[model samples]
Target: MTLLAFLGVALLVVLAGSRVAFYGDALAEKRGWGRTWVGLILVAATTSLPELITGSSAAFQGLVDIAVGDVLGSTLFNLFILSLLDAVSGRVPLLGRLHPGHALALGFSLLFLALQGAALWWGGPLLGPVSWYAPAAFFLYLLAARLTFLYEKRRSLGQEERLARLYEHLEAAQVVRGYLLWGGLVVAGASFLPSLAERLAEETGLGAGFVGTAFVGAVTSLPEVVVTLSAARLGAFDLAAGNLLGSNTLLC
Candidate 1:
């Protein structure tokens, strides 16, 4: 029953997640924000709902290790999904077509990881009630977002008029509504996953850390996997790659 329920929820998430990718692409076109920007900020945040909810719940319950493991594991799992996307992308290569601005995002992700490692090694908070690294990471994320936005803006110059026509048949309001509606469904379905994961972990007799890292993390990242593939299939490769890379950075 547990396994069946897990699979069922996963299926729903996958279906909703695919819709999210299409709507996200539409939103990007309607807004002329570029696929990379939309994927990084919008789609990534929406798909990351599971990790956010699960980690917060675990942290509230004082399961610090589970929370931390879930974040770190989800980040790793998201990166793994990128490799999967590459493999399935065929002859042209998915990474080959990505915008160079993504390298900036990757650099920030690495910096965030290193900060996390330093925090772990220190074994104590450098700031009141939270590690200094937490705020530092947040600051760096803001900076990275700003820089990437500018970079994408410059690269997308004179292209907005062309991009806008891509979704001319649909109203901007309609696209936004569809994106939010599917995104909300994705979030709703994903929110229940953490409890289901915990139950399955108990039934399987797995340790908390292992279950959190492997089972919970992978389950939570199902949205990313489905959404990325959907974007790739739609020929929105930038959106696909941005979703994965941005998701890792967001989780970290």
Candidate 2:
């Protein structure tokens, strides 16, 4: 029964995510936001939502290694996803338009790993006193954005912006209906899903933490791969490269 409920909730998360992606692609079309930027800034984050949940829970539960390992390992996989995007794009030369800014993302990602390493080492066995590592990740996000601006300015590349899908499915009535209503549904759903995942570990001896950290983690990360490959296949190398690498930098 527990596993059954979890499966149902998992189905909902996937369904909600698919709706979000469809509306998101349409939203991008209406606004003239190029596919790459929309995938990076909006789509990537939404798909990574499961990671944020599991990673945060692991961190909050003092499973620092699990939290750190998941991000680190997932990032390596993200790189694999990028390499796959480049390979499948068949955009010739393979190194074609491999944006210098993406190199910057790799550098930032290295720095993030360094910080996480230092925090865990210096903070002792618990890795909690250095919980500031989480917030510090945001500062790194700011730095990435700043570097992006500089990169584009140097190369004369224009700043890109995408349309908000909120304008569509979301309405004034929905907004006025209050956070307690829709927000509650989202939160309830959120709370329901992860706990269901947790329950799987409890009942099945499969270790929810590991399943959530890995199996589910890989599942959630797929949308980025799909969008990215689609963009790359279209010969949008820089945009595809930028979305994956840039998102890795921000999320890490």
Q: How well does each candidate superpose onto the true structure, as a TM-score?
A: 0.90, 0.62
Clashing pairs in 1: none
Candidate 1: segments with Cα more than 4 A from true spot: 1-4, 123-125, 156-162, 201-213
Compose the digit string of candidate 1's lDDT tens values, residues 139-202.
8888978887777777655566776677788999999999989899888888888778878887
Candidate 2: segments with Cα more than 4 A from true spot: 1-43, 124-136, 153-213
Q: After superposition, how far is residue 168 of candidate 1 from its true place, in Å?
A: 1.8
Number of the top-ranking candidate, with lDDT as the measure: 1
RMSD to truth, every model: 2.3, 6.5
Q: How close is candidate 1 to the true structure, as a TM-score?
A: 0.90
lDDT against the true structure, each candidate: 0.83, 0.58
